[model samples]
Target: MKIAIIGTGNVGSALAQRFVQSGHQVSFGVRDASSPKSQKASTIAGTTLLSIEEASKLAEVIIIATPPEAVLSLVAQLGDVKNKIIIDTTNSIRTRPEPYATAYHALKEITKSNKIVKCFNSTGFENMNNPIYSDFGGIDMFCAGDNKEAKALAQNLAKQIGFSECWDFGGDDKVELLEKFALSWINLAIMQGHGRNLAFKVIKRA
Candidate 1:
């Protein structure tokens, strides 16, 4: 899989590294070609720095890792990605501690005809790199996309990166719910000392 990660933040870097390590071609999509993080990993053969358009053109799976506010503008710039599978890792929280637009609204507005699977937004960056499932526990990673094929592709990718319980929440309408889950997790991490070690586990007795 040729993967394009649009942002160079913790989530973006972590996902890029994981994908590269998993033997996939990685393009670190960034505004500046000479960014330190982009240059630091230049020695890796298949990892390259590319413009958003180049990344979009070359990669089958494009992960939008930009901050929430930038998502719409970025997608607009990327243009017609109809039928392409997009993994949205954006969260709707701004720097001022105020919530940005909801993921549902963002995705709906930005994605015209693209197949977007919303995942990697609900967990912390630390957990994203290496999510551990203890013997008695597992995390529920929610994904919702209108296209079934796209959702399945995203689910397979998620599982490849150590995510276990990939819950299909049905359609792109529920993207806001996933963002809310992340927001709630942020608050809990601050208050409950939960940090990245804790994740929601759904227990069903048979």
Candidate 2:
């Protein structure tokens, strides 16, 4: 999979490295290729750095790990991505894309693409770096989107990077709920005194 990560922050960097290590082509879409963040991310061997438009053009999937409000700008810079899959990894808990509830909502409205899946936003970046806990084996991931194939691709990508399972949180209507789920993680981990090491996992009794 040719993947374009639109941000070089903690979440973006982690996913880029993981996907590249998993044998996928990972490219970074940035405002300036020479920026410190971009340069630092480029050091992660096999990762390509290009303008937002360029990276989006060549990648099969584009992950938006940027601020929620950033979609307003990206909607124009992204060119035509109607045919590509977009995975939004932002939460509206902190700052939302005004008018739209979450980044996923913004992207869905702007791109009008059904291939938009909301995943990778419900946990801390540390967990994203490595979902596998030495004691627990591998933690679970979750996604929600109307497009079955798009959600399947996201689940496959999550599994490829060590997550035990990528549970389907539900379809598009459930996207905001997933964002709330992310806020719950944020509340428990950051606001409630628990450390970043904390993660969520479903337990089933049969």
* Best prediction by TM-score: 2
Candidate 1 has a TM-score of: 0.85
Record all residue pairs in model 1 with backbone atoms less than 3 Å apart, i.e. clashing.
Answer: none
Best-fitting candidate, scored by lDDT: 2
Q: Which ten residues in a row have the lowest lDDT in candidate 1?
A: 95-104
What is the C-alpha local distance difference test score of each model?
A: 0.73, 0.91
Against the true structure, candidate 1 has what lDDT?
0.73
Flag clash pairs in model 2.
none
lDDT tens digits, residues 25-60, model 2?
998999878888888998988898899999999999
Model 1 agreement with the true structure over 30-122: per-residue lDDT tens digits: 777787756664545567888888888888878888776676567665656785678888776653112335543565555665577888888
In candidate 2, stretches whose alpha carbon ends up further than 4 angstroms from where it belongs are none
TM-score of each: 0.85, 0.97
Error of 2 at 22 (Å): 0.6
TM for candidate 2 is 0.97
